[model samples]
Target: MADEKGRYSNAFTATLAGIADLFRKQKNAVVLSDDDVITGKNILITGASSGLGFEAAVQLARRGAHVYMACRSGIPEKGEKVMQHTGNRNVVMLPVDLSDIESIKKLVGQLKEAAVKIDVLIENAAVVPSGSRKTKQGIEEMFMVNYLSKFLLTRWLLDNNLFNTDGGSIPRIIFVSSESHRNPKAFDWDGFGKYKEYSMGKTVELYGYYKLLMTTYANELARRLNPTSQHRYSIFALCPGPVNSNIARESPAIFKPLLKIVFGIFFRSPKVAVQPVVYFAASSDVKDKTIDYLFLMSRKEMDAKATDVENGKKVWRLSEELLNQHGVVFQKSFPPRI
Candidate 1:
């Protein structure tokens, strides 16, 4: 019989290996510097309690950027641990629950009150609920956390003028998506509400659907915003290859042991998995480009067929409507300067 690692093998691992191989082939690509200073930059990272998001926050702070970790429980102990590990003092913790719209609003409101401008926004938080769950806003759990919440948050930031920096440039918004957007089918729009039960497989499928939606929405928002001239805010959706993260622990108990074994052998470290995001956030090469989706560290275009521009527009409209219904009027200006 195949071992646990072999049993859970999928295309995600193959794709990551291919990307690593490509990096090796490019012998002259510039390597990252350990002393790069990102001083004066304010970055906000979601899901900073652990995994890739935590790594991203630590690394960004190490680069001299002020990092705000947005988590569900603003635990000072966890924040202290991250600061100690990274040896960076520019890290702060902000509590937020993406599943709840009000929590998101309060989080942003606090940032706004502080009069801090966000130079980079990483929508890295996600949830793969084991069973069918609904957010406080009565939306599908996966969709709310992985897709809609990001969309709403970005919209709010832009509208409130929190992302606009001096000299007419807007902050960057990076969406942590997945390669699973290439799946050949669209998700059932109403199924999220209809399903009252949950299973491991169902959770994975729902999460994949959210990734698809994210990729589609990223492109559409870029087009609508059209960052040019002074307000040069751009957006990029990134597909970080699978890594040894706790995301798999959300699976059924029967599958946890198997996934743990597989992830142990085949998954990349959280630090490595977040390289693409770090590069996108700080690299000078990609500055001001309205990229659709990036794979690894390369600026690869996503499958247009999979993104479905029409569907993306529909989703955007629906999102705006949803926010408006909740009495949340988002701003339209880039970076949303107050």
Candidate 2:
């Protein structure tokens, strides 16, 4: 992988470099300590009840950003915890079930009614299922929870003009991806939302597949948004290298303890792993560099086959079709980037 000189000799080396950058003295690059870049900014983050999402919410709120914690349950308590921890009374919870489209619509309605202008949106909710499970809408649980719902929500938010509508500043849309995405093949277009060979190994494999979809989405959405120019928003994905969270709770019960020990010793804890996500959220280094797949606060090139423009378009088209089938309406053409 990395040579003695610390040069990236290959994909593995590049990956290791990214992870090492994660542990560097974490700092908010956008603000000079005497200044605050995120003060008064509005951010909506999913999966804010725990793990990387929760950590990012806390850090952002601490910086004076108004964070709307969107999760499936325990909103009141989690909101209170975040409020107490950050001393940011602006932190509030909004109910959302990433596995359900109707719930997403409800969230959009609420945001619209509240006239909330979002400056940053973090699509960070995900689940790893050990078995073949389906959502209430009959989609595979892993597919629904991990990628499709976020895809739909991002598109809906943009489609309905719920973000970056004002000419104030460049809004951002960040996707939480994983380095494991590099290990997967091109997305399974036809096989998605269908249980194909179900097993623990298959589930693990599919999790990477969904992450691949998420990685490609940043590129695809960037492509769609770049042409118009005035309404261009920052779009990128970050991989918080191997966080020791409940993400793997779906694994076999026997391996749970062993997995926790191995993860604790080998991988970074969720608290530390969240630095990259937080850094990417408001970092000056990434503000104009859109459509990046980052790890450890650095941009990493994706597999060519996965980042190909044709493949990106295909992914976007399929996502639109799926969402349309579920009754979402695409209203306006994309506007120009500022």
Candidate 3:
């Protein structure tokens, strides 16, 4: 019903929905204090080269966290900019193409070689392609970058024990998901990971579907990692609302000018839209919670499909199967509760 009212299946409708959502009065809104900080903690964030991810790096670095910018481009430049803006030399850049499995594996190996134990990992990288395309591994580009890569990367990190899960503090895993995840009616189980051709018209719809897969995985990750009464990790996800960013760079040229105008006038700037992300990363209010979701600084529940126990298990199983079919194997065992 909500999706039927304001489906984010198109750029125009999505923009309108975003603007309307922001103006609604927020209840139980959160406030981040100066005392809330992540000083000396190692934080790895993907897609840190631009948009919400870039601003998040700057703000988190400013809060005294050692920020690792995992990106496909902007290798040294973005890292340099974050350091210059935040005056925190702990910022470092690591390169990885989310569409390629080898690249994801290489990223995991690099962190292992460096002995970098992540205190917080923000899975922020995503793409809105002009059409269907294949990656180096021959999988659908959007499917890999938007959803499967996160599943693979998180598993690799956890299997290798890259998260700093010591008794000192809870390790946080944050997913930069979208409210558009609710647009999809249900899972396309028959075509789960199979590559298919699509045009720009289908991109936005698929984006929401991938976000659904991701949000479900986030729920599943929390369940698998912290099976006992004692919470071993903190898994969080949120929709930062409409960020005026380059995510729509793939849109047709005819609409670019108008889209830019609307985005500039209505959408929240990356600096302002990134508050919820910063809150999840640094605020003390969420550190103790096993899981939480936020939309524009207001707490909310994820879609029912994403939170369903059966759906979470099925997503986890199907994801593992898909990766195995692609010859990417998990080197270590998971927490064995399940």
Candidate 4:
């Protein structure tokens, strides 16, 4: 199989691709109305310290949602900023290092201990590292942060009954995936969950693969959670397109100035790029759907590979097995086979 599929093989290519996408008319764009209110809804957002995640927290807070900022850094200060900007004091900061398994478990444990019943769980935490680095658990840092952490965190939440599913509104699980998810033609099944050294040259390629893993997992989670079209929970994944954010903070110094110019000139700001996420969190249009995806503000289908039943099942199984290998056990009976 090709190392990667489609156009986005590296940062330069990916940036160009995103820019090209912006020019295309969003024919299926769904407007987010000011009337869609999420007042008092307990929404948990990961990576809310900066960039798109931070903007999302602010916007959601402005809509009156009880925003929980789950992040690795920027504690009281970030939370305070959300309150300062939105005049909403329901925002709370919850620290979590997404690259570490123990830290994720600690975060979930803290939420459960506090009896926090989350209505909207936004899995927005992600990283684009300079090169391949190992987490404390000896897994690749990017893989752990960008994909596996979401799987582990969401599973623990469901297993512990942390989601407020009994409420009048169905709980929503939103993933900040990417259009790059379509760039990986296939999965690296043999190399799954194994750490191998690589440099920036291979970073974007692997990034797309991990995204495919995440998108696949999202589909499978929807299948398992809302079987027979019951639509118990709304599972959403979206590509916010390219946002001018700190996600590329680790780029080589020589290219930083150039990237800054290109991103500033072409990329959308975090505030503008976060509309789809806000729509998913607060909009009633998608409240009853089992699964949904968006590219920019327009509704779109996920890649065929991501939507494949066999691929989703295999990815789900492998992810569970990998976690088990790392000593993170699932206590409850998971979904029966599809």
Q: What is the TM-score of each candidate against the true structure?
A: 0.85, 0.86, 0.97, 0.97
Q: Rate the local accuracy (lDDT) of all candidates.
A: 0.72, 0.74, 0.91, 0.91
Error of 3 at 178 (Å): 0.5
Model 3 per-residue lDDT tens digits across residues 1-338:
46443469887777788898889898779887778888999999999999999999999999999999999999899999999999999998999999999999999999999999999999999999999999998999999999999999999998888999777678999999999998898899889999999998889889999999999999988988788888889999999998899999989999999989989998999999999889988998887798999988989889999998888988888889999998978876454345
- Give the TM-score (vs. native) of candidate 3: 0.97
Candidate 1's residue-wise lDDT over 1-338, tens digit each?
11112212233443344345334443223335565567769999999888889889878887878899999864776678778977777788999999899999998899999887998999999876767787776776777888889888888777777885678666788999876666535556564333256565556555666777787778777766763444366787877776788776556677677677767776778888888888878877667576645665555557564456577677677677776776877656332111
Q: Candidate 1: misplaced stretches above 4 Å?
A: 1-36, 187-198, 227-231, 306-308, 331-338
Worst 10 residues of 3 by lDDT: 1-10
CA-only RMSD, every prediction: 5.3, 5.0, 1.4, 1.8
Better of 2 and 3 by TM-score: 3
Model 2 misplaced stretches (Cα beyond 4 Å): 1-36, 195-197, 228-231, 333-338
Worst 10 residues of 2 by lDDT: 1-10
lDDT (tens digit, per residue) of candidate 4 on 1-338: 24335668888889888999899888788989999988999999999999999999999999999999998899899999999999999988988999998998898999999899999999998998899998889999999999999999999998899999785558999999999999986788998899999999899988888888999999998888877756688899999999999989999999999999998999999999999999999998997798999999999988999999899988888899999999989986457445
lDDT at residue 216 of model 4 (Cα atoms): 93
User: What TM-score number comes out for model 1?
Assistant: 0.85
| Model 2 local distance difference test score | 0.74
Clashing residue pairs found in predicted model 1: 159-331, 160-336, 161-336, 161-337, 162-336, 168-230
